[model samples]
Target chain A: MSNEVEETNSLKLVTPGHASSETEGRSVDAGPGDADCSPDGRVPYMMSQIQETLQTLDTAVDTILGKVEELHSKYEREGLAENPVLDACREITFACCFHDLCSQRLNIVLKSLEEFGDELTDGSNGTREEASILASVGESETRSATQDVQGGGSLLNGPAMTGEGLSQEDVDELLKSFEEFN
Target chain B: MAVDKNMPVLIVDDYSSMLRIIRNLLFELGFKNITEATDGREALKKLNRDAYGLIISDWNMEPMSGYDLLVAVRKDEQMKKTPFIMVTAESKVENVVAAREAGVDNYIIKPFNGATLKQKMKRVIGDF
Candidate 1:
């Protein structure tokens, strides 16, 4: 079966030349039967490739970690407790009801909005106005909820906006309530 | 006749930021006595403890929504017929219809200007 070839090829280990030198004490090609088949050199060869790949990955991971640390330092230097995205999420339950201002500082939020907008347009693009409107709608809801909780009122009472019709009686009741508020 | 200035207005929402925003907005608009609740259940608790002239609520929430709050407010003997408005992001026609059926006094869309809010308030207050 081709699977056997794949398995064998997959298992062929290639060690880095440096690694091979470091581990020269270990006779990697000690199998006597391998003498007939180029000393089964495939194993060490593949191992080297894998080790190189791993090194690359490790270096990349370290670079990313360093970048994150640098970003953290930047936030601290600017006197921000955290990055804007984290700040905005935390504010969802505590402060900064108007997420629009916060989102301005958060690249992640902008990226997410861009992605969402792309998906909404089905890749057709050119819907900046639509995306902006939706973003505002989201921001308004966030603000309302924040304001309601801060006012010691239930979360249900914040001012929300949407394009919807109002009936006369409904208006009457609100008007009546406003009466008492006045 | 002006509504008693001392009468309280209860505003509820799930987000603290919005709670502060609306409270400040209301205060700037001359609403001096205000209370807050984070959800419908909490609003009900506050309602049971005191009287309010107006209730402004959001429609969607966790642990009891504004719709639930409106129904409860209408059902309570002392709170029934108290003025209530449904301020919500659910701008669907069906949602508004439901709010109207449930007895919302007025509806205003989001991202509203202070003038619009004041206009709505004047309409509700009748004296403004």
Candidate 2:
């Protein structure tokens, strides 16, 4: 039941004053990308696969990290040396976070190149504006900027964040820079 | 040995996150020109299209893994000279020996940091 409410809220974030009824049948809401989505709002087959794979990988990382956290909590009172393992975990988290956001954005560029092969046949003339236009992909946060992900928020669950799309952490960070980006 | 920081480098891995992490480490070490491929087949495609100073690839992937890629690259006269570095989680001595026999220039174990990557890069393409 809570999933329904969370999903509904995710639909609400598509655009200010946009009608939720207009977005009813879409299985996923990709934030800004909704504006450009097909009427049925399905993601491209390849992009959906990529998003699914990335989400699985992110979940795997989260699972491992969670285990480490649990270990840390379990061992803290044992008086064993803890800094070495904790420090390594910190570094691993940093690397994982950086990799997650940076690669998702890079995949966007690669997908654009694949989809619009004719426009970029020459490869040299693709402009920043063209990239931005394509970046406004009609999917929920297929990815966020490195700036948005630095906080270790659980943004991978989907554009519907915590349970659905944007988590509170993700939404707050995104809102801080929303006006600047738009 | 000395190396050119600006030389084009090709990195291959099915996991985009692994690619991103390696690319960032290379970037930090002053190497800027980088291309990425998800499997050995795609890496070969890029190898055919352009010259790379080095190739760093993971060992496991669908349709093509880094070992097959290394053998193919070694067989190709044009790409045989390009330094190849294999990256993977496998630490078994036999795996390292297998990569070496296949003509890999170096090997990197997974969960590596910038220093380890830089050290591997030094062994293959020389110090940056």
Candidate 3:
């Protein structure tokens, strides 16, 4: 009976409890009362973080754009009409347009985050419904953008190529294919 | 009529960066007379103010898209015959078909370099 009591006590020591040394090192599964249960509070925090990151990106783009414009003006004033230099300037200017593209895409994300934050802070049953609706809207937008990139469904709905843009050879081949079809 | 490189050309896009890029490309192609508008509505207002020899426009814009602009241009008696090229990131066949049906002279996909732009312009307005 004493051995049985000792075994029971040992088992109790291993069981999860505030005072159990054994339980200290083991991670307990989170329950409804845990700090992680209400993640709604973190939504605004995450949104703010994203907003800050986007602002940084915007500032970087603006600085690059400003520098390019200044270089373009300098080139013009210097009467540097060298073809290669002019061509490089043009290419750099074209590349700078990526900031606009990024801004457009980021706007979509920011809008979605704002909607989600609003839903989270509402603290009503409608929060779930709103979240669901927002999620679906986001999903649909993503799917549509994907479809546009993939050239899925109608051939006329999206970009000609996915990431990295189309090569000159690819463009030529596409033109040929179109001509062949026509 | 053969394209006159100095003839006034109108470029339209909602993104100013895109407008600047297109203008630069046109400039590189030896097109000296170029005008820019931020969107289709602005393009229309400019269209009424001046006669453009050619119109190159981005398809996606708020309020009035390039398609709407094209339709409006086609409907107008004065601008009906102007060479119009629809530039868009979208390469969907449906959009191509619709633009074709709507009487677009040519289509150019985005991220196109000067060489590609030159070729497309040559096709639309004849070799510059």
Candidate 4:
């Protein structure tokens, strides 16, 4: 609802859609209440009325600026300024989401495989293995979200895994040793 | 006994990254028929719907915990014998003893790599 400050700046509610388009803030002709706008575009100092109008306008501008600043702050945090840290954070978040997507895709494929194999019916053997592996030693449950890469046991501590291939002599010596054993 | 690459395995965890990490490690170890779940309750639902050869689960979860799930599965006649491995960060001695007593086939401490995972799998389900 637009608060129609009438010819005289006493704030009053206009009957919403019923207010005439032109009577929104000004009348076709000057009336006793509109002595400040005597058919000229110039604004007159209507003392108390002018002060109240200025205060309202100031308040409205502040509200709008507050909203704009909030939006700007949000954009800044989201890397609208091309901040490297924010960009990295966003990439990490996206990578995590990608991880979930891939995991879900794997689950979907497994589900379809199960339905297709239908181990009880004919051709079930395609997915089935010997029953020995399925035997329980014990039973449980759980998922979620990874970060800490603590080597909690001796397993991760034994070696610094390298992607680089071994030296030619190392490979030759290793193959020769295997050949001798064979 | 030789482990079948196609043997259906169920892995449960709530974290997607951890889930992906475990799945990738399993894939590297040649296990293709893998299923995933976010928690014990969901895992149990899947367990009832189908059969899985092995279960790798985490200890901490909501609604139903891995420990509780282990107890429930051990109590259930149909699922009591299924191999279970606890892959989690819960490394306290008491927790390990409790899991052993509950019949857990193996326990894997967190931050493990493919080699670590493979060793645990070998201990629990034989060589793949």
RMSD of each: 19.4, 18.7, 11.7, 26.3
Per-prediction DockQ, in order?
0.10, 0.04, 0.28, 0.04
lDDT of model 3, residue A3: 14
| Residue B11 of model 1, lDDT score | 90
Q: Score candidate 3 by DockQ.
A: 0.28
Clashes of each: 52, 10, 10, 17
lDDT of 4 by residue, A1-182 (tens): 34344534453323222333444443322222444334221222222333444455445544543454455447666767565643443333223433333333344445444433333232334334432223211111112111111213221111112432233233334434544675
Number of the top TM-score candidate: 3
Real contacts retained, model 4: 0.04
Q: Give Cα distance to truth, residue A11, candidate 3, Å.
A: 33
Residue A5 C-alpha lDDT in model 1: 15
TM-score of each: 0.45, 0.47, 0.66, 0.43
Give a tens-digit lDDT track for model 4, residues B1-128: 68788989999987656666676557646787999999899999999989889999987666667777787788889999999988665555445556666778777655455555677688678876
Model 4, C-alpha of B76: deviation from truth (Å): 1.0
Q: Which segments of model 2 are wrong by more than 4 Å?
A: A1-56, A59-182
For candidate 3, write residues B1-128 as lDDT tens digits: 66778899999987766777788668757898999987789999999999999999988775677877888899999999999998777555556656676778777777666677788889878977
Q: What is model 4's C-alpha RMSD?
A: 26.3
Of 1 and 2, the candidate ranking higher by DockQ:
1
lDDT of each: 0.56, 0.61, 0.68, 0.56
Displacement of the residue B82 alpha carbon in candidate 3, Å: 2.1
Encode model 3's per-residue lDDT on A57-85: one tens digit a residue. Answer: 76776676667767776887798868466
- Strongest candidate by DockQ: 3
Model 3's chain B yields a TM-score of 0.95
